[model samples]
Target: MQRFGWLFLTSVGAGATIWCTHFVAMLAYKAGVPVTLDPVLTIISLIVAIGGTGIGFAVATWRQNRLCSIIGGVLVGAAISAMHFTGMAAYRVDGIIEWRWPYVIASLLCAATFSGAAFAALGTATLGRYRIPVGTALLVIAIATLHFVAMTALRITPLRLSTAPLDSTQMHALGLATALVGLVVIATGVFAALIDRWTRSDAMQRLHYMAMNDALTDLPNRAGFQSELARQLGVARATHTRLGFVAIDLDRFKEINDVHGHKAGDDVLTALAHRMRSEMGRHDVVARPGGDEFVAITRFDDRVQLVAFVTRIEAALKAPLSVGPFATSVGASIGIAVYPDDADNAETLANNADLAMYRAKSEGSPAPCYYDAPLDELIRDRRELANDLRRAIDENRLEVHYQVQASIATNEVTGYEALLRWTHPERGSISPSVFIPIAEENGLILPLGEWVMRRACTDAVGWENDLKVAVNVSPVQLAHADLPRLFHQIMLDTGLPPRRLEIELTETAIMADRDHALHVLRQIKALGVGVALDDFGTGYSSLETLRAFPFDKIKLDRLFVSELEGSPETIAIIRAVLALGKSLSIPVLAEGIETGVQLAVLRREGCDEAQGFLLGYPHAVSAAGPSAFIDGPHIEPLPDADDISNAA
Candidate 1:
């Protein structure tokens, strides 16, 4: 009944109104003889009319079928006929009254036919808004026809005069009282209907609000954001104003969840959401689309204003936040795209902003990046490069180039480090610095890394001299791939001795997942392959890293070698590393030896081995002939700057 509250109110109102009208009409009738109505029968008739009509109204509207409506209407007509007959039975007159059966049957048929037609009309689509009024008018006609026809059936033979004859004035008073009471009952139902309508409207509004908001952060969700953005864009277009869309993605949020728990991550996100909301301007809108991502819309007049606003947001976001008992700070990469400037539509604008955000993430810049045409082109180019790299791995078109690693004291070649080189059929010799990152990002590094290891070992096994071959392993490969098993298989397939092969990795690679990477490295070490830490001083917790892994060699990053002559700090770091290597019984190799002086510095500092342009440029084993002399100074010119970044 609550679900159909309005229908319930309507049924009660209509039934009561029908019963009251019948009594009012009967009371107005001018009968010369005295008459009275039974109180018990009169009350009983009203109850029957209300109950029967309520059931009929509910059934008629319950289904859209015409048959159901007709059945319900007939039931209502029967109730009316029953009520009329029952009221007649209560009437007392000083005469013998009889009914003509034909007239009585006619009245019953008229009531049923007209009432069925009325409800059937209410169920018709064509009736539309006219259904209620039409149904009500038909019901009124049905009631009047039944009452008048049934009255005509009454025939009286006077037996005697009554002792108490009802006077006209007394009858008028009773009729007036009945009419007032009936009006009051009908009025109550109308008031209830009005109350129900107001309550329903309020409930719908609340439901709409819940649907548009985020439960966790109480921020506008994606649907709500899009609606507000479209409205703002319309206004911006009409007024010739600029609107900026800023996309923010939290960095290392996944790590936080992995380390502390998701509950801590949630607390952090909620705190950040509150801070962002507090920082927003009155006209600005901030929303969390999902996860650790947030988007904000701001109206600005110029680039200067936009920059200032973005700077403030960055500062506010970087503030310290509490996660349980501990306090930590999280950084965000923000990207911006402006209306009419970057894009005209919402989808394209959001996409451009996302592209800029990814670029900022790649560059690791503190400042937010704005969408530019070149960024889109760079993304397309990177995608194409990734595709080509995949094909290269499949076709074995990539090459392994080796640069000689020789002892600083003896100038005797100890080994060669294999560097991966890809010469695109069209682009020609794409640098490892550029494509290596792409490979790591797209998961091509696993195959690419394994291929490089296998090829290097195969080439080294065929060499005349017994020399260790070192292969660079990507951090992504080390963390995600089965490195120990892959290397073991490669060594077997290539017929290379495990002791003659070396695996080179950076400190950052081992730090990615210390327990797992160490577990993998230990497994590989058990196979008798030497492990070397490359780019030693460039990563975090250098001393801690050195203590954790038992390394066979430590390669100082080229950055320190380049600064050797100019910076005293560089020389001290080199000496300390070489001394540390000596104490640990490990060899220290310095890379990026461009001039003779850099080489001389390494020799005087007791560095064990070195590899750079001065020793030899990275030439293919097939080009250099694996047995080439190592003592002679290189006559060939040094590699250009583009080749320098490829230290793999």
Candidate 2:
């Protein structure tokens, strides 16, 4: 709106000046003066008027110097004079008429009046400082001088008795006076406009600073920081220089605010800003992005220079601060990201820096760390997997590959654990370790998990009556809104008995939201679906949580199973867990068994069931149940320490 107002004022002023100048010239020609050179004079007047008006308008629009307006006025007046003089010279009257003194005097007076008026108008429009009274006085004097000069130039041929003799001395005196007055008028108008423009420009500049700068520390604020960051990034990219941005979050700043009050906090922030400014180079930018958050952007020759710069800032921040009467110290954990390295743009760089800063804060380190490819790759891979998992839902690429669980006493398959697998088109056979967390992070587990549940149920319905299929559910999936509805749909779609479908959840999955998890588990249990606690020994191993949710079985983590024979402590812990599960009427299943000795120990400890490579390696869904590996002399158990030492 302000810009439009400036344009409107300039265009109207220019048009008005051009029209008025032409109208006055026409009027002059109509007033009995020879207009032989009127066309050429008018053309000159039009150019001068348009050019002066354009210059004045431009100066006003830019809010530049008043000298521009003054110069414009002077040019306009000079142009008018030159045009009038040229027109007078071009006069060619083919008659016996006398060159009257009155006619010459009138022409000069008219020229002076027109020139002075135009100059004064331009000056007043452009200059904000000078008063109108002084300008008017100058204009009057300029008009009087022009009239006198014109009269002096006149000569009467064939002088009548009424015509007094032309006095050269008087005429010369009059002409000199007119020239002096005209010069004074133009000079005054120009000078006044220049002074006015200077004063207003200074005032505006001060206002602009106040608006852009922070009040407390007089540093740039968040908005200003964004603008500066963009500008600096552009410069760095153009110059092929390294641009570094560091996001600094003051450690324990909240404590200071809580103890000393907000006023003291403000004082500390101001002092800190001063210190930061002292530490920064002239080309660097430092800004307070938010409460207790400061950001710095600097150009460096390379990564090493950027690291050194960050180190210096970290060192400076470690120094003690004196806020009011209290001497306090605070440390800052800074996250450093370089342009065209960590990110290609401003917002991405800032976001990545913030991520790195949080990582630093979590690690409890004051030292700066550069953004590494591994971290970016980890995030990128997770995002890609999340997207792929979503597509897998539509394409039916997600499947539950079965691993047989066997009973040692009967040497028969009790059930099969349904492990989820994804075969990506480009990157084939993605591991559960990689995509499972991704699924949880992106909430893709809800739909993918539902599909797993439905597929497992359908597979189980086709299998022998005794074999059950256990499908693992992520914590996010368990917390889903339609969990019970999904279970019911799966049972109906597969025409599988509810007892044949078992849902497995980790300790973290159940403990994440105990009430919600328990409620969902109870709903499934009510439908006659068995619920197993997967990886029970790891995560939140609370007896209260176990008692809250009525789990049908507890699958011990592979970590505990792997060390059971080597560590008596691990064996004892597993025994206790197994005893607890039995007491609670929950069957304990040992996982990752690899040899007869481990299997024998689990059996001796009275474990109910086991699943591992020793029993059967995980197989495709189309494969038959657990393979039979009889306990014979040819199939020797893994050697113990004594046997190995004796052999050596």
Candidate 3:
């Protein structure tokens, strides 16, 4: 319907221009006779002109069929000729006016031929380069040829005054007015066409923007990022220069979004984009390729200069972003890859940078690191481990090995720390440290965590002395809103008492979103489950964490225990941590007591419980319940000087 309306308007405008042109040409006639127009005939001629032009425009715009264009153009030409002839009939002369047969036929033929050519040009692409110019010339020639031939067709036999005709000034004024009307009609049509074209172009540009950019940050999206990177890579290859690519991931972004809501997340992204742009040079490109992930491309002089540039940009992005009522802290983990150094192509460069970035994040490295070939093995190993881990979960091949946690005072097994162990079909024993993080990153943690919790609880159902089973909870698990519900559901399903389940996390995990983690922890505790802070005193503000949150146990980090005998500062910090836990009524467990000296020191220092190879190594906890612990925990006698070599 709308298209028809445009066609109608176009036809009317064209018709008006042609009608005015014919009227103006008629005014130029000097028949030497008093002639006045017949109003009815003149009005009929305009109606024919408008109708004819409407048919022509309808055929041209609706289809590209050549035959249709020719037919429509012929009808338009016929209507135009009818109007011309009809207007001549309206020219009532007081004297006889003779019409020349040849001139009349020529004028009629010229109108049809020129009009058909113009319409044919509109219909087909065959005219090639000459289409526009030739079509335009034909139009001018048509008007000129028709008007002059028609004038010659009219001959005045005598001069006589009739109805005073129109005075010379009035005739000239009418001619000027008709010419002005023709110009106005043409101008209006062109203006409308320009506006329509602009509107469509602008809409297309908007769609292109939507396709190429991230809506949240208004930065180039993944497609745009990859395209621009490839383009830059071409330039670098051509010039034999180096290109630096950084894959950056904003840390704790999920926690921010989960704790503060999506609006805060968007605010952080926008601020980060602005910071990136501000810190980058004109040749640099920054893009938000995905959620909480940003990539940058820049030219570099060398590896050192690339590192320096990345460090500066990373530093700028570390500034706090204001999100509504409070300011949120966010930091980035960057992985750098250089062309001709780390990779030969854009895809490899991007992948290597991403791998490096994840490594920095997973290892908790403070500085951005360059891509190294040795790191590729670690990545491949993790990937293979992840695939195996998935199969381990599916094939019921996942096993739980319990490390005995003993009472230092009684020297008896108190409870067991259930550790996940995957003995891959090909790789044998794959460490939890390697596979667990990979699971978290690949989103296998949810199912893996559920299976571990359920299996551990199921395994501990009927233990001999009712020993508790402690399970480590990742920050990923804590971030889940359904974590508490899932835990209780698992408890119900396994029929294992909630009190027997101990969920351990670190100070850093709780600090991710202290209020949320605290809430989740308190809810778990409300269900009679124990919440312990694992790897305590290893992260920032261990004292503050202990003071602020309710914790049933504090597991001293293994590193501090290994360093205890060699470093006095370590012993001092250990004593301080023990003192803090004792004052708060929280039992402190020393981990990694490989040597008897370390165990004896932990005992002397009033540590409540301890676990390591010295006291007990991780052993497969049988589903046969209490017999697993009844078999007795591993124990080490006081180490002799000779035993120091095997302590680690």
Candidate 4:
């Protein structure tokens, strides 16, 4: 409706211009007879011109096609002819008049031809910026030709005596009134055009702002930050100054999001963004690229200055911020890269900073880490290893080794835990710890875990004894794959009974998403597959996890077992976990039993099962057959329970 108003204004202005031109030309005529206009007819003609042209312009605007433009142009020409003829009818002259049919036909034809051409040119994109001017020029030619030719088509002979018409003063007064109205109409059209342009400009600016800013924080988003960084870099280059790029990651932010609702998480992020902005210098820019990650660009003179700035930001971020009903604190792992010192370009500098950030996170460094060239090499090496692992999985070069889990009292092998072992033809054997994290990070764990499960099931099905096979599932795998369905399918494919298969997952995996993990575990349990909480007492909310899931077994982490010799605290935690498991009717399995003393202590503590090198080392399926344990490591006999307690 508003856009149509502009068109209407334009039509009124154009119509008034045409009407005024005709009347002024009449007033300029040098005929000897006196003449005056019919006021009623003049007003009616003005109405016809405005209404007709308005419809024409509206039709043209509604569709930008050649046919519509031509039709619109015809309407406009017809309106002009109507207004001219109607105004001429009001011309009260004492004369005899005659029309030239050929000249009249030629005038009408001229009006239609030029007006159609004008509109058609306006619709042509090839006309470029000259379309409007060209269109206006042709329209003027059409109007002028129509008026002059129509006048030439008429012949008037003056009477010997003139009838009384309006005096010169009255005629001049009427001309002045018409001129005033035409000026008012033109002014109205100009006002509408100006308003429309201003409104459109304001809307465009708003859209640009939305594109460049984060809606929640009203801060510059990644794109906006990059643009600002580029501009700042240009300034720094001109002035020969150094710029620092700091990449900040909120530690355990995913835990926060998973534990609390996303709304609370959003609140936490919003608070952090505000606090970060407040901590920055006026010339510095801070942006939240996505998902608990933020970045800042600041100018610094030296490393010390940059470090001080980063420290301030870290302190500010670590401070408690309010979120909804309560306040929560979050830690930041910041990585810094200096311009010209680290890298010359933006992309390289940003990558260096991100590499450093991951290093800080991995090292658990409280202070910010600066980019070092070695970090880049390490990342490259990891990426190459990831590619190799992908190829290894594809080629079936990976192998599964099994370590026996046995009853504490009888020393009878009850089950075996499947451990993945990778040996690169060139790199020899690779530890699970070294490549497991890489697998998790690079999303290779899903397929790798499936392979291990299927292979373990196939190997276990061929075992002489009906022993269970346990496989470790990473947190990434638990979160992504449909474990129950996969387990069922793998068991069917390998012809292994569900009751003889078990999945060992860490508390950290359950803590990542307790409800979802529990739901999946229940479904797996319904299929008769066992689920054990592996690496117990190492993650947050251990007691809560035990209470939530009805685990078939609890595997005490190797860390606790390793620290049992001198750490009374380790003994107390182990005792408590064992007691809790016993009370819940869930058997406790202690892993990492390298020494006879560790086995004796766990046996004294009433641990149900144990697995480590002391009992049997992990070996390939062929080496780990039923009779393979005949040559296992020798174990020292346990002392009296009271003596063991006294020694501890």
Candidate 5:
């Protein structure tokens, strides 16, 4: 019903424009003596105008489709021409009013041409309501073209009549009346156009507001934060000022939300946003990028001032938030990266700040962490290493260095563990920890893992001793559904015994996707390949995970082995893990045994196997070294930078 109402209104508007255009042109016609309109005929012409317009509106908008509009437009042009000619016939003079036949034809053509243009303008969908002004103007042109051209077709001759035609004064009065009504119609069109424009502009403003703001907290969102950060960064760079890019995350916010409902979570976020804003200066920017995450751009004169500001914010955030009837307490972890000190651009600054925040969260400290230069260096070096690793993998520059694993009781090399070794032409030696994560994240782990597996199988086939080759598989690789199939294909192609090719995984990897990991591990076990749970005792629910999977070997994480000498608690944990492995009938291997002391402890603890620097450094399969395993080995642990040379 509302749709029809709008259609009716549109039809009336269109009819008014046409009627006014024709009448005004009629008023402009001066026959020099006297002229009047036939009242009945004039009324008939007005009805024709309204009726024709209604027909056009009904058909064009009936389907609201392009084809329908075009077809309706043609019919509308014919209706407009018919109405113009009907109005022309109503014009009265002292005698019969004649029209020049050629001029009449031209007038009809003009009416159809302009009326079709007007219909096409209105029907156009791409000309959004924003084009109302231009559309109205086009309609005006259409009406004017039809009316004036038809008026030009009139040819009147002076003649006396006993019925006394309307005088000059009466004619002028009619003209004035027509002009008044015409002005009103045009005015209405202009007013409607302006209203449409304002409406569209208002709607656009609302969309922009929604885009830049968080709906829940009414604070600036991530997009808004990036915009503000860039602006501030520009200002700081121009003025030589150091701007602090602080990334803040509400700690344990999930726990609070889980305890309460989501509505309470919204209330807490709003409260936190208000608190953050309250602590900001006019120039500072505070925004929420995501759930319980906030970023602020602040100015500081020096590092000390920045530290003081962070302290003030940390203290402010410690206060409990009153949400509904409950007071919810939440702490904040903050990371600060100084512009012109840590990074000059917005993205780098935001990333550095986020890294610092994670570092602070990991430390479990109350204090905020500031991004230091060494962290930046570490990240830069890691990025460079990742690039080099990609190239190394592509060019077959990566070497499969084999390290010896020996029985704890016999002190004889039982087998060799295949390790990926990269000696960059520029950086010399890059550790697996440094580049393996890079490989995982960049999706290079798949091909790299495959290469290592194939190389291990190929190398083991050529070994003088019928020893097994243990290869470490990344969590990324373990997640692949086709890993077992790929492993089977490698063994089939290399002709290496599946039992001799052991695939090692950390507990983190298995637990990452339990169902898929279990499925893949079972598939590998079905192929008669050895499955070792590497870094067993470190991850969560270690014992539970151990009982879940049928692992052939359990390699203890190096952390426990490193602390074995100094900490009794560490010794006790290792003993417990060893005992658990023994009870489960899964052989336990102690990794990172650097000295005879650690080996002696493991031997007494009933460790089945051990491997570390004390066993031998990882070397090329063809290289002759003590990698086969040596007994009674003793040496102090090397520093981390140099330890990568020997430590597996």
Candidate 6:
């Protein structure tokens, strides 16, 4: 429509220029001037025509309304006519011809009629909307028809250049051609506009979809999940049906991603999404709310169906998945909350389910657990414990206990491993195995670890200078930015030489951030302190980890030492590890040496030191002094041959 209006304006302006130019040429001829066409005049006439057309095109393009386009077209035509007449009046004739009233009247009438026809075409084109080419063609036909009719009424002599008359057939053919051109032009303009609109709309729709979907899993994203949850909640309220929302998270997903590459992790998530979708009913909605997190919403007929449905989904997640070279087993811990039961709204329900899912993860299992008040209470207790842990170090409620490390060859005390112990005012004793991990997780280990190092160093100053004191360092503590400076300060404060302090770290700790760990270990070694790999065979330790760090000691995991007599594989693994340590100039210490046979085997395998209940149980600081416990073979003997055979 806009294009047609522009075309009409173009035609009207062109016709006006042609009529005015012809009338001025006739006037000059009547005045007895030699009517010779000059090159300058021709150029000026062409410029006027082209200028008028350009102005009309600009107006049509600018105005969207049909009426505005028509008015603009008429104004453009009047300007072109006036300019042409003014240029004609500039001519100097040889003699003056009388300005006859009849010629003047006829010329004015012709101008008015032509202008009216041009305006009519523009109005028609404008009414057709801005179909530029069609409007231009229509104006051309109308102007030609009006010009021929007005010419027939003129009293001037008609020129006959050939036998055929040039009036009727030529005029009719021109009109028809103009009309056809207008139709073609209008059709082309409309087609172009339609294509432009469609392409833009399709692009926008694709962008919208991309924004709402997860790139990795190709599932609805967090925004989409929230929208679906709100929609379902409304429907559930209206229909009085139960709506269940389950928040599911994969356990130890970060560990998997860290060990393998992100590409393998992505593949695992994609497979998990497909598995979840297959397990869900058609009406259920599943979405990836975030990394390794998925949410499901379903409208259940009753609570029983909801429970059964969640159970089925949990079982589906427990199945093993093959990713790249690894056959991995991943499980989902699901937390379910039903509408008007666990929560009445989306936010509350989602939050409560998330809290419950963490609780399920804390239980260390693959199962679905419904949200309840007890779980909330447990979370509160954990929070309290984290808060109280800060004061536990300052108030000296946390203390070090000594577990004796003895030489396997001589059966004499070599040193002691310093272990952290917490004695709660109200709860009595808390095991290091339990609270130590909690401290590491909640970021309390930075301070708690520093305290342990200082206390262990202070206590070791009391022991004989030849005996080493081992202090276990959690991975979180090892990752601390200021650990080197803190260790130096503790060494200065305790007046214990760096050689007397031995720091123990598990394999996982060294492998967690290999580069950073190496840098930290190098800094500690530069201070003349010894580094030991603790719980050596328990975690995913590549041979690279052992080769990278200069460990002074390797503590064999208790699992390998416990089954040494019963399983020949365990014994062989221990021996191989001991030999590897010797080859690297690192001493190997066997943990959990509880019997005579185990001790004898470790001694034969060239193990340097051992620590377990059979050696000496962890004792209080006062009982931790060198003279408090006996050190030689007479102190205690490992279990006899009968006991070892029965144990095996």
Highest lDDT: give the candidate number: 4
Runs of candidate 2 with Cα error greater than 4 angstroms are 1-232, 237-242, 245-335, 340-369, 373-395, 424-428, 479-482, 538-540, 564-574, 622-648
Q: Candidate 3 residues 1-648, lDDT tens each?
A: 768767776777777777887888778767666656777887777777788788877776666688887877776777678778877787776688888999999999998888888777766687788887877677666666777788888787765555554456646656676777677688879877886898799999999899999988899999988889989999999898899998898888998888999988888889889888888887799999888989998987667777777987778777777888988778888888889888998878888888788788878887886777797558756766778788888989988888888988888888888889888888788788878878987889989989999988998896767889999999889988789999999999999988888989888888898889888888889999999989876677556677777799989999999888766688888999899888899999999988778886777778999899876667776643456555666666656655443332
Tens-place lDDT digits, model 2, residues 359-439: 677678768656666664554455667888889888987767787787765566778888887889999999999888777
Alpha-carbon RMSD to native, per candidate: 11.0, 14.7, 11.5, 8.0, 8.8, 14.8
Best by TM-score: 4
Deviation from truth (RMSD, Å), model 4: 8.0
Residue range with the least summed lDDT across 10 consecutive positions in model 1 = 639-648
Cα lDDT tens digits, model 1, 1-648, are 564766656666766677777788888775667776677887777777777787787788777799999999988898788778877776666678899999999999988989999989888889889998998889888899989999989876667776666755645655775677577676866688678787889899888777777778988989889998998899889889899999999988998898999999999889988988888887788898999999999888887877877877788789988789878898999999999899999998888898788788889988898988786659657878999999999999999998888887766788889999999999998999999999987789999988999999999998766888999988888886477888889989999999999989998888888899999898999999999999987877378777888999999999999988666688888899999999888899998888766776677678888889988888887777686634443633433544332321
State how far residue 188 of model 2 sits from its true place (Å): 40
lDDT (tens digit, per residue) of candidate 5 on 148-185: 66667666667764555557675676677567656766
Q: What is the lDDT of residue 629 in candidate 1?
A: 38
Clashes of 6: 13
The better candidate by lDDT, 3 or 4, is: 4
Q: Provide the overall lDDT of each model, using Cα atoms, as 2-decimal numbers.
A: 0.84, 0.70, 0.81, 0.85, 0.78, 0.72
Candidate 5 whole-model C-alpha lDDT, 0 to 1: 0.78
Q: Which residue pairs collide in model 3, if any?
A: 464-626
Q: Write the per-residue lDDT of candidate 4 for residues 1-648, one digit (tens) a residue.
A: 777777878888888888888888887775567666788888888888888888888877778678999889888888888888888887776677778989888888888888888988899899999999999999998889989999998787787676565468757866896889778777887797789799899999999998898988778888888899899889889889999999999997887788888888888888888888888887788998777889999887776878778888888888987787877799988888889899898888888898888788878999898888876569757867999999999999999988888889887788889999999888899999999999987889999999999989999898767888899988887776487889899999999999999999988888788888888888889999999989887767467778877899999999999988766788888999899988999999999988777888888789999988888878897655645853433455776676567547
Off by over 4 Å in 1: 24-32, 38-44, 51-159, 162-212, 259-264, 302-308, 323-328, 339-348, 371-511, 514-648
lDDT of 2: 0.70
Candidate 6: Cα lDDT at 419: 83
Clashing pairs for model 4 are: none
Quote the lDDT for 281 in model 5.
80
RMSD, model 5, all Cα superposed?
A: 8.8
